[model samples]
Target: MKKSLEKLLNKPLPVDPFMPQRAVITDIEELAPDHKKFSFAFCDESVNDSWNHIPGQFVMLTVPGAGEIPISICSSPTRKGTVELTVRKVGRKTEVLHRLKPGDYVAIRGPYGNGFPVGIMEGHNVLIIAGGLGIAPLRSLIWYILDRRHRFKEVYILYGTRSYEYVLYKEELKRLRERNDLKCLYTLDKFETEEDRRWADRKGLLTELIPMVELEPSETFVAVCGPPVAYRFIGKELLKHGYPESQIFVSLERKMECGIGKCGHCQIGYKFACIDGPVFPLWDTKNLPEMI
Candidate 1:
């Protein structure tokens, strides 16, 4: 019996190898004042291929002289051929990326980090919260859920920006809100004019609107992405409403080099933000330093 068991365990198992290679930027589009979207296709057609990424996963982008940075996959898996990323021009790498146009070449490392818990979120109401550039990553999960709307109970999206002019995906948000299957809300810190106020749906911080929204804590799962300050405040409000820590997912931003966990730049405690997570359960690392 022992010999038979050993023989079974020794049998070869099939696995797919990870491919890391150069990809060319086939398209680039401006999304907001400081944000741009880049589209890539594999340079080596036979070996390097388009990525298979779960919502919330990110890729490390490298330019020869500028260095590398981890940017989230904003495009949905439902889209084929090319993958897209929305980058805000806030740092050296991004500024370099912003200067590059279509036909430029860049190195792509991975679709790293654990993604949103789609399997667990299925059948539960989803409440997505995004602020500023945070929408770049959360857009993936939102598209995934929208692609298979019937699989979930209800979907609600609340997005906040510093001003009306800073909102991302305004047209897309307006279209999605029209769908009876989903509910969407847009808020700003304050309105700039009477015309802006007429179009503005919600005002004040997003956390303020959270209290008035109707949701069943037991049946709902919340996903939040934003700057560190945004997470600190919104997280506290979510907890106050009795949302379990495990049910709250957050995407953290950090400096990253290699997206394959080979570099220590993105490390937080013992966790590598690029590999172990960019997305983590709120309670999983709530006690870890710099996690907030």
Candidate 2:
């Protein structure tokens, strides 16, 4: 626990919060339609060697001339050295990033946001729910827990996507599905082909899959990331099942510019999502105005 505690991303903070570190794109894999998984290594070996972050933290990536955007780190801290970011082609910044090739350079700052407190989650059953691109950050937490499976009890991964074609990490999810240690369930909104039906364990909204989990409500900690509209439904579903609001965490999607919270673009109530969150207890959603 001491070693893990020492590695928390909030360690004294970086000397220069605004300075971007140069990193080279090592590999690029097409994850889904308009989405790509990028592998990066810091150009300075010292920076790479010193890097450490929790599961739900994100980085501010510069898209050369276009601008910068915050993206979640999809790689587990357990697998150090090379970092991974799964980006979807959405707006101007991401559009430019999609055109980059392997070996091209990019600048990034952060490992930002208050990440999931995995330490507290240890010794309890884990419920991870993801929808659409929300799986990006949850992927990091999934690997972190999987890599140290002994620390936790039963683990369940419930992921829902629009269709088979839009599901990211197809091969990786297949491998996880084959594993005996954890339960992996998937749902799809539609099936375009016979293969799509075969891939999905169920068909419907992600909320529909929640009722199927059989864990003791008090002994589990839930992490959810998905469409903002889905939060209220999911929160109610979990509460209906007797899970405590304090133990349920959600990674929020906010338009954060300056990762240090000075930009004020990601304000939720009085708190800034960039520094205070991006990851917050499910209870916050209820107390905070317009949170969901």
Candidate 3:
């Protein structure tokens, strides 16, 4: 059985890290004015099911005549044969991507970067906090844990957006709220309408939700992904709540040109965000002041 398992694990997969593969878009869903969720499949079916990636890893995508950009894999590995990317249009490459319709083919490479430590998180209560577009990568972790719910203890999710219209993954969040196995809290920066007030459980900074949830500092793992401005404030709150710096993980956003470490665009202090992380623990990043 061990030999068979090793063989299965070693099987080849599509979309090599260095070589770009052709993938056809199967569906597209517009989550917000500037954000869209894209679903794709490798044009070659044989390698579709073989591609495996952990949550929090990212892939570089290429749009012909435009350029390539790094995007987080939003779908869980449990959903085999397909990959999802949630893109927010901010630059030329993303603008071109936004114009693409279903059935278009794009070049894809890599499931790059060190991801969240799922092995260590197993059997521990998990708290995931995502702000704005940061939810894209964290969503992968959320789904992975939910799929194997029995392997984990308590699970809690805190998501904050700019407003009700800016909320990403609204339908799925609603479904998550219905699940008895976990708990979810949604908040917005400001509430404009009566409906908005009624829709949200809270309306303020996401950090406010931290104190409301019950957490076991020693047995709980906290994963945070958000804007650079949110780090210091959120980190301070988590520490105040009794979580050790080592048990708290953060995902940093950097300008990455090449998906590999050769590019200097994503270099921070002595480490490369592309290879060393997009996800890192406080213990590993504390000395690197620029990362926080």
Candidate 4:
């Protein structure tokens, strides 16, 4: 099953999606060096109480004098009143964001884009795969599925990062691996360090972990979020083992430059990444030009 384009087109924002609203950073937790999870509560009490967003959708966060950047929601919609974004300090915009402290203000808006197909995914087996920082958006889906565990049959998480030092949400994921309800498999590119050996399940590229998973291909719906270059290889490996291309969804958050379609930077063929998707079926890369 898939999200219908007709339904998505009919959905409209209650207010202007691009309109910025003020929010204050309530807490900031350092997940790793250069990576921080910032918690925000809308400045207005009503907005803070009513704010909700589907997993995989993103918000345009304006860093005051810096600039606005599209960052995916790393927190679950199941948690209300506050939202969290795990930001990696990579460029000028993020570097500015990282310098800010709790209680600082930022103008933010939009839970834009077609999110994960949670409606149809109920009752199906789910495989969540993340590479490096790709775990950001998928973290929301992971929590959503776990909070409502009875709705789905089986769930698996396969995450790969450069090394033990590069792994995000280290403690949370370590606890998740202890759960009996779902499976969590992790791999690292460098495992020479004793910490890496103690933490990771394997060492190699993420694609190498594919064959180790045991799932019924027809019943499984896979969600992948990672570097764009990994898409082709991940898709190829999944398809090689009988996974359906239509059932595999990939988040293309990197393609988004602006939250509204007015900016042409996120165009892939005729589709606008901001409006049409930040999440798309794996088959779309084959049908749409320059999708990857």
On lDDT, the candidate that comes out on top is: 2
lDDT of 1 at 269: 85
- Reference-based TM-score of each model: 0.88, 0.94, 0.94, 0.93
lDDT of 1 by residue, 88-206 (tens): 89878778889998999998767788989888999999999998888988899999999988899888888888776677777787788789988887788878877458545777888
Give residue 105's lDDT in candidate 2 (0 to 100): 94
What local lDDT score does residue 133 receive in model 3, on the 0 to 100 scale? 95
Instruction: Tell me how many residue pairs clash in candidate 4.
Output: 0
Q: What's model 3's TM-score?
A: 0.94
- lDDT by candidate, in order shown: 0.80, 0.90, 0.89, 0.89
lDDT of 3 by residue, 59-163 (tens): 999997898899999999888989999999998889999999999999888889988999899999999999999999999999999999999999999999888
For model 1, the run of ten residues with the poorest summed lDDT: 11-20
lDDT of 2: 0.90
Q: TM-score ranking from best to worst?
A: 3, 2, 4, 1
Q: For each candidate in turn, give its C-alpha RMSD to the true structure in angstroms.
A: 6.1, 4.6, 3.4, 6.1
Output the number of the TM-score-best candidate. Answer: 3
Runs of candidate 4 exceeding 4 Å displacement: 1-16, 255-257
Over 4 Å off in model 1, which ranges? 1-19, 46-50
Cα lDDT tens digits for candidate 2, 179-290: 9999999999997789789989899989888889989999999999988888899999999999999999998989877989787999989989999889999889899957
**For candidate 3, what is the lDDT?**
0.89
- Residue 54 lDDT (model 4): 82
Candidate 4 per-residue C-alpha lDDT over 1-292 given as tens digits, one digit per residue, 9 for 90 to 100 = 1125324765422434667989999999998889999999987665665577888999999998899989989999998878899999999999999999999999888889988999888999999999998999999999999989999988999999998998999989999999999999999999889999999899999999999899999999999999999999999999999999899999995446677898798888888889889999998988984888
